[model samples]
Each structure stands twice: as C-alpha cells, then as structure tokens.
Target chain A: MKYVDEFRDPAKAKALVKEIAALREMITPHHQTPLQLMEFCGGHTHTIFRYGIEQLLPDWIELVHGPGCPVCVLPMGRVDDCVALAERPDVLFTTFGDAMRVPGSKKSLLQAKAEGADVRMVYSPLDALQLAKKHPDRQVIFFALGFETTMPSTALTVLQAEREGIENFSLFCNHITTVPTIKAILDSPDMRIDGFLAPGHVSMVVGEQPFRFVAEHYRRPIVITGFEPLDILQSIWMLLQQMADGRCEVENQYARVVPSRGNSPGLDAIAQVFELREFFEWRGLGSIDHSGVRMRPAYAPFDAEKKFAVPKLRITDPKSCQCGEVLKGSIRPWQCKVFGNACTPESAMGALMVSSEGACAAYYNFGDLQELLQRREKEAIPA
Target chain B: MCLGIPGQVVELIDSEQMMAQVDVAGVKRPVNIACIVDEHHPPEACIGDWVLVHVGFAMSRIDAGEAARTLAILAELGDLQEEQAAMHEGAR
Candidate 1:
C-alpha cells in the first residue's frame, strides 16, 4: 500500500489539480479550437472521468477516450465464442471478472452459467490453472484477455500448464496491441486529437519505442501516464504544454517503471509462445489487420481454439448500442443512446458497459457514471 | 502492449523458476518467471537487483545508466519546489 496509497492522497491530488488549473489559466480564453487530447488508454479514461478530472479543467481542454479498453472494443463474435465455450458440457470457462456480463450473440458468460455452464472469474491466469487442477475432469479454458500488460501472465500459465502436464486446461487468447490500435485511431479521418495520453502499463513492456511511430506519423505529442488521478492530471498538463508549444514526441511521465527498450525477457517469452495473426476481428473495430496474438505451433496442445471447438456463432451488437462510436471517440458516453436505460452495469447491451475497465462501466460502478448516462437519454435525438 | 515494470529479485524461489518481488516506489508484487527466459537472472541479476517484470516474468536486468537517469529526473522534480520557492523569495 506504500506506493499505491501515497499517490491516492487527496491532498496531493488537489495540489496537482491546482497545478493543472494554473496551467489552463495562463492560456487566453479566446481560442480558435478547443484542444482535444486523446487518451489512448482506458486507465486514463476511467481515471479522468471517475475523478472528474474534467471538473478541474479549463473549458477549452477536452479528453477523448481511445481504443485502450480490451473488453470494450472486443468484437461481439469473440464474446460469442466465449459464451459458446461456457455452454459446452464439461468445459469450465475461466475469465477475469469483467467479461462475465459482456453480451455475446444474445447470451453472455453469465447467461451461459445460468443455463448450466461452468464459468469462473479469476483475477489472474494462475487462478485458471488452479481451477483446472481442482476440476481435473473438466476442460478449463482461461479467457486470456488483455494488452501486453497481461500477455506474460497468460504466456506463463501455458508454460506452467505444459510443464506440469495439465491436459484439461487451455487459453482463449484475446490479448491486443496498443500501438497498432492507436494507429488505427490516428489513421481514421475522425482523429482531431491535438495530443495523446498514452498508456502507462503498455509502455513498460514494449517500452517508449513503439509510440515513436505514432508520434512521428500522427505529429501528436503523447504523454504516457499512470492509473492514478495525479498521474492523469499531470499528463493532461504535459499534453497541453506540448500542444501549446507544438511539439510532437513521446515523453515518459510514468518513468518510475517504463523505459525506452522495455522488458526484453517478456518480449522473448511471448515470441517463444505466440505469433501474430495477419488479421483478427474486433466487434466494433472490425477486422484490424494483425491486431492480436495467437498461440504458436509449439504450444498448439495448449491453444484453446485448437484444443476445443465452440459452435460457430452468428452475433450482433444490440441495435441501440453506441459502443462502436464511443470506442471510435466519435461520441462521448453521454452521447450514446442506450447508455443508462438500456445499458446498466447489471444488464449491459455492449462490451463497454460490461467491462470493469470500460469507460462507461468504470463510470457506472466506481464513479457515479449512471447519472451521466441517464442524462444522455434525454439529450440524444429520438430515433 | 508492453506493460512491464522493474522489480528487485528477492530470491530464487521455486527451484530453477525464480520467484521475485517487484517494487515501484515501495509497491511490491510477486511475479512468476517460468515463462520468461532467465535460467539465472542474467549476469546483471541478483538479490536486491532490479529486473524488469512483464506478465509475471523477470525479463531482463535494469541498466545502471537508465536507472540513474530516472532517479536523477525524480530528484530534479523533487528539487523544483525549493528552487521555485527561493526564486519567489528573491523577487520579494
């Protein structure tokens, strides 16, 4: 709690807020365009919205969420695949807490569980292995979902499972690439971003190098920031300063962990175990070319897709769900139609509301997010 | 996708698979390295030595130059307050 609690100190957070407020005050009120800084991480999005970081900001500054939430942007078909796995007899689906409620082809893991499937939510991939050990007769498939931050844990789980000869366990890999997804956003004509609040965790693994491609090509300065309130506020200030000065380069404000080269061992482990597919389908993002990793041939025995077959599913996002637009940063959460009415934390219409880290869900449960969503119901044009 | 952090290897727990604790400003989390490629924490890795951890594996040992540079930057940020306070006093 030492490092964690100190950063959460309200006094320290307020001081940072004061600093950010001062930074905004210096800029003249009359401006051509409001500076829109794209936060390319879900953590930053949740932190900013949850803590009302915007409340502390000057009106000209705006924060746009990016494709950082692994759950929010996961295409419906993958969730449908997970639901199919959960529905199979003798198959135990192990996943993080957030994926349980994510809607998949008219059903979710939670719904599958209700219809008599063994769905267990775990905090780590190690937990899935433990579940497999406890239930030897059942096939335990860990819903391996995350960015580079979580891939090593998933990779290690397989290695350990293979080493121990655990035959009943496998993994459904949904780990994604932060840089390429960010590239997809930058490449989109809709990107009016002046700067970016880059992901803090991803930077630690791939290091500060991958982001250079983004900075160089997009010509948008990115400040890689941490998960806490102060980390986000500081990043916003740094981003604003960069935009004000017209600088486009990557800076590590979260240098306590991330570096230029990153952890080569982690990279090597993933390389040993997994390979990138030429293209994979993300529900909202469609088929992003080579955006995901799959198990290598060496680890085929442990690959969930190879080991087990879930019924091919025809899935669709709810007609009312505006998750696609929200993820694209075309519209904020409040701009979505089914935000609070059709999509509560308990009954989410899309992956955004179902994921614990998803901007909308993070707002709903942790940050009084439902109120804003409800407000949107009245504001949205009647369809 | 890199979300690796540097942690100090406390011990070679679990036989050939070393188990170590990673600290970031006194934040410590236990990580497994069976998946990472360090039969022995490279020559640079040792007890009380900082190694970069990703997904539960100690991937590589932290470089001294970069470590020093990070510490120096934090130090400079820490020094900013006193420097600014002194400047204000001189103005008064």
Candidate 2:
C-alpha cells in the first residue's frame, strides 16, 4: 500500500478540500448556472463514492458523473452477440468477471454458462489463448471489450496466437476509443461540463495529446486523474484552479502513472491489430462515429465477427431508463424514477445499474452519505 | 475494470515471453510485461521495480520519484485553515 495509503491520507484530503473551496469561490460569480465538473472516468466515480469525496465539497460545485464505465455502456445487442457465440457447441467463450453479469437482450453470459454453454471467465487474454491451446478442437473466442487501456494486451494476444499458429482462437472485438466518446459527450445538446477529470488509465495508454481537443475546440479544462482518494481530491482541486485562472487546458494530476507521451509498444500493437469502425452503438448513448475498433483485415483470421453469425440487431435503451440523461450530466442518477425502487443493482433494469463503476450503481452503493447530508440540510431549512 | 494497481516485480517466470510475477498489495500473481517493455524504450523492468498492473498485464513502469512528488504536492496543499475549520466543527 505504499503508493495507495498515502493518497488516502485524511490530512492531505482535508487540505485539498480547503484548496478546492477557495478555488470554487473564484468561479462562483462568473456564471448563473452551477459550476458543474464531470469526472470522465468510472474509476474516478468509484473512488469519489468509496472515500466520500463529494461530502467534503461545497454545494456550489456539482460533480457530474460521465459515461466512462465501458461495461455499463456496452449495448445489449453486443451482449446478445456474445450469447450467440457462447451458445455454439463448437465454441468456448471467455470474458472478464464483471462482463458475466451484464444482461443481453435475452440473458446474461452467466445465465448462458449455467444453461450449459462453455462460457468461462479469464483474468487476461493470454489465459484464454492458453485455454485454446489446451482444447485444440474447440474454437476459443475472447469477448474483448474496453477502452485503450485494455486494447494493447488483446492486440498482443492476437499477435501471439498468430505466431504460435493457434488456428481456433479469435477475438470478439468491442474495443472502443476515448477521444471520440468525449467529443460525442461535448457535442450533446445539454452538456454543461465546465471542466473534466480525465481518465488516467486511458490517458496512460493514449497520452494527453488525444484530449487536446477538449481544451482547443470546446475550451474546457481537463485534469488526467488517478484512481486514489487524494488523487480524486487533488484533481478536483486542479480543475477548480483552472476555472479560477480563466484557463482551459489539459493537465495531468496523475503524472506518476501517466506520461505526456504514452506507452509506445501498446499503441503500436493497437495500430497493428485494430482499425476504427464507422460507427458503434453504446447502450445509453447512441451510435458514436469512430468510437469503436474492429480487428484489421490482416488479422481477419482472429476476428470473431466474421467467424460467427451474430444477430446484428440494434436495441434501444429501456423506456423508463434515464441513463442517457444521467450520463449527459443533465440529471443525477437518483432522480431517475427507477433508480432504487425498480432498478437496484440486484435487478438492474438499465445499463448504469449493471456495473459497480456505473453512476447509478455507485450512487446506490455509496451515495447514501450525501443523501443523508442533503436530508439534514432540508430539515434545517426554516419551514 | 480499468483498475491498475501498482505492484512490485517479485520474480521472472518466463523472461522470453516477458511474463513475470508481481506482488500487488502482498498478493503475488503472474503478469505479462510485453506492453511496458517498449522497443523504443529499453526494457529496464527488474525484480523490485514497481509497475502498474492492470488485468494481468504490466501497462507501464511507474517512476518512484514522480510518485513521491505527487504525494508531496497533496500533503503540502492539504495544509489549509478551512480544513482545520471543518475538523473543528466535527469535534463539536
């Protein structure tokens, strides 16, 4: 806990809170609307709730959770395609632990596994390749899904498979990019994001150069943030300082993990294996152009999309679900009608409720402290 | 699922394959070091060096000095009167 424990120090957190307050005051009079800052990463969202960071902030500064949770944004149609591949008797489907619970149009991958499909959970793509080596007769399919953070490993695993001549292993590539998604969010009609707490992991892979447009085009300040408590608090403080200084730029608070220029070998592997798709569908957000990546033609032998006859169906978000609004920062997660009552984590009716990193799930799990604080505020008001 | 914890390299299980064992918060596990060992940047990963481990792969090598600097900034900024005031309110 050398790197972690120091980031969660209460004394440091207290100081950051004090600094954030003084900075928030500088921007308070400039705008009629609240100073809404969006943390554009689910990891940041998780840390904020886990450490009760929101409670330390003043009411004038509102933290809006963005659509950073990749699992939560995975369309039901894609899940259904995964189910289709898993149900094949000759195929052995593998995915991460959290992806098992994500519901398809009909059922989740867990449900498919329970019903006797060869759906397996793997810690990495190499493990899936190992499974393919073990079962030479069966087709091994890795349900690859994530941002630039996880892309390199999958690309390298595919490269390894090709080198070893592992004929039966392939990838169900749902790999997406972060820059286009951020652009999509910024282009949305109701976007009120004053600044951003950029995703550290993705930035570590793609670097801060990809996020220059957020500052250059949109004129919003973004601080690439770490996933620890003090990291979140310090990042929030950094964003506030930028607003106070009347400057819009991309800054790195998690400079320890993120370099100005990112991992080269990882980016090289990604360039070798994947190409941007024309448009890809997100669960809550609609089709974003050049947002998703597909396996290149050279690696077509390892592309699962061509190998299996998937039901390429487009499914809309549920009628009652306000995940789009929540993702867009137009509304808070709790304001959704189905939030706690109809769409708890146990029985997720929307995409946000499916993943722990999702805004709705984070709210359901750790947002009670803020809720209680709000309740006490309402009670204190003269009636 | 983008949880990359900083773990120290404990052992090299398969150096040719760039696979090594890293200890993350005391739990040791085998991880691929290929991504971090960029051709442009010489592979300096050795036993005892800290790397950011994400999904059984070493994403990047973490600089200890940079990590210390970040921690120092947080500590220095945390010294505030408002924070002291908030703590005093809690004491009451």
Candidate 3:
C-alpha cells in the first residue's frame, strides 16, 4: 500500500482541497458553461465518487464521467454473441467476474451457466489457456475486452498458447482503442467539454503520444490521471492550471506508472497479434470507426469469431433507458427516467448500471450520504 | 477496469514462465511478469521490489522515489504550523 496510502492521506487531501478552492478565482467570465471537466476514464469516476472527492471541489468545476468503462460500453448484441458462444456444447467460455453479471439480450452469462453451459470466470487469459490444456477435448474461448491496459496480456496469452501448441484455445476479442473513442466524443456536435482527465492505465501501455490530438486539434487540456484519490486531485489541479494559463497540452500526472513512450514489448505483442477493426459498436456511443481491435489474419486459428457461429445481430438498447445521454456527459445518471426506480444495480436495465466502474453504478454504490439523500430527494419528484 | 495494485515480489515461481509470487496487501498470489520482462530489460524484480500487478500480470515496476515525490508535492501546501512542528521535530 506504499503507493496507495500516501495518496489517501486525509491531511494531504484537505490541503489539496484548499488549493482547489483557491482555483475558483481562475474561472473568469470567458470560461463559460461552468468549467465542465470530463474524467474520461471509468476508473477516475470510481475514485472520484469513492472518496467523496466531488464534495471537496467547488461547484464551479463539474466532473463529468465519460464512456471509458469497457463493460459499460459493450452492446447487448455482443453480450448475446458472448452468450451464444458460451452456450455451445463444444465450447468452454471464460470471462472476467464482472462480465458474468452483465445482462445479454436474453440473460446474463451467470444465467447461461445455470442453464448448463460451460461458462467459467477467469482472472487472466492465461487461465483460460490452462483450461484448454486441462481439457483438450473442450474448445476454450477467452472473452477478451478492455482498452490498451488489458490488450497486451491477451495478446501475450495468444502468443503463449501458439508457442505451446494449444490448438483448442481461442480469444473472443472485444478489445477497443481509447484514442478513436475519445476523438469520436470530441467530434460530436453537442460536446461542451473544457478539459479532460485521461485514462492512466491505457497511457501505461499506449503512452502519452496518442492523446496529443485532444490538445492540438480540439484545444482541450488533458492530464493523464491515476486511480488513487490524491492522483485524481492533483490531476484536476494540473488541468485547472493549464486552463488558467491558457495552455492546451497533454500532461502526465501519473508519470510514475505511465511512461511517455509507453511499454515497448506490450506494444510489440499487440502489433503482432491484433489489428484494428473498421468499426465497432458501443452500447451507447453507436459505431465508431477503427475503435476496436481483432485478431490478425495470421492468428485466425486463435480467433473465437472464426471458430464459432455467434448471433451476429445488432440489438438496440431499451427504449426507457437514457444511457446514451449519460455516456455523452449530456445528462447525469439520476436525471434519466429509470435511474433508481427501474434501473437500480440489483435490476439494471442498462449497461451503465451493470459494471462497477460504470457512472450510474459507481454513483449508486459509492456516493456519500449527502449526495445519496439529494438523489433520493430528486427520485421523489415524478419524471 | 484496470485496477492494478502495488505488490511486493516475494518469490519467483517459474523463471522460464516468468511467474512470480507477489504479496499485495498481505495476500500472496502468483502473477505473471511477462509484460514487464523484455529481452532488453529482463526480469529485474528482486524479492523486495514493488510492481503494479493488474489482473494476474505485473504491468510495471513502481519507482519508490517517484512515489515519494508525488506524496511530497501533495503535502507541500499543507498547514504551515504543522510543517514547522515536523521540521523542528526532525531537527532533534
């Protein structure tokens, strides 16, 4: 906890809060729209709500959550495809713990398992490969997802599987790139974002170079942030400083973990095994071109998409759910019609309510007493 | 969901496989060091060195000096009287 405990020091947090309070003077009349700052990663959103960090900040600065949670962005059709793969008699579908709870078009992977499917939760893709090794007769398919932070390990697992001659192991790749997705968000006509706190873990793999467009093209300051409380506070302070100084640049607040040049071997592995898909559908964001990655042609033998016949149909989100607005930072999660009443975490009607890193679920699970009370008060008012 | 935590390397389980036992918050578990261990870098994880372990893999080595520097920057704007008291105590 050496790196973590220091970031959570209450005394330091208070000092940072004082510094942030002083930043209110920097927001002049030119900074219209209430200094809307987007924490572009779900991890930052989680940390912000978990430590009651918003309560410490001045009301002038609004921290909006972006669509960075991979699970939250996974469309219903993809979940149905995952279920299709999982239900196959010859296949053993392996996925992460949180993904098991994500509802598909019909049911979740957990429900699929209950219906006698060979679906298992794995911590790593390598664990799924071990399953293939243990049961040579079964086709082990690892459900791979996330940004650059997780792409390297999945690529490496594929390389390892091939090296070990594990023919039965394959990958159900849903890996997406963060840069294109961010660009898509920035290009949207309704975008009113002033600054950004970029995803730290993705920066660790892809480096700071990919985020330069945010500063150079869109003219928004971005500070790559860590998951800890102090890291987030400091990053916000950095973003505010850039805004005050009239400088738009991609700065690194989590430099200790994220190198400016990125991880070389991880990049090499990703390049060797995967290539960008022309377009991919996000749960709420629709289809963004070149925002996703699939196994390269050479690795077709290891691609689950090629091995299995999934339901490749696209399913629309529920009518009452306004996840698109929440994901675009246009509306708060509670402002949606079905927020607490119909889309509570216990019975989520949207992807945003399913994942812990998701904006709605994070707000529901970690909001401080005062915030929760305010939300409940709003819930009392009819939609 | 990249929830990587800092963990101290306790032992190397398989050198060829690049697997190591890491102690994270007093819980020991095996984590792969493949991503961090490059041909140029090699496996630099000693028994006590800390690494950021994410989903059963060590993503990167945590620099102790960098960690201290970040902590120092955060604590710099703290109460002046407490800083003075701490300085005075250190003088003893």
* Backbone clash total, candidate 3: 0
What lDDT tens digits, residue by residue, belong to model 1 across residues A224-248? 8865567787887787676556677
The candidate that wins on lDDT is 2
Chain A TM-scores, one per candidate?
A: 0.87, 0.94, 0.94
TM-score of chain B of each: 0.49, 0.61, 0.61
DockQ result, candidate 3:
0.17
DockQ of each: 0.12, 0.22, 0.17
Q: What is the TM-score of chain B in candidate 2?
A: 0.61
- Rate residue A222 of model 2 by lDDT: 94
Ten residues in a row with the worst lDDT in model 3 chain A?
Answer: A1-10
Candidate 2 structure quality by residue, lDDT tens digits, A334-380:
87767887788998888899998898998888767357446545755
Model 3: residues with Cα > 4 Å off, grouped in runs: A1-7, A367-383, B44-47, B64-92
Which CAPRI category fits model 3?
Answer: incorrect
What fraction of the genuine interface contacts, i.e. the true contacts, does candidate 1 reproduce?
0.23
> What TM-score quantifies how close candidate 1 is to the native fold?
0.78
lDDT tens readout by residue for model 1, B1-92? 12334446666556444455445444454556543435554422566666655434555456655445434433333422332232222222
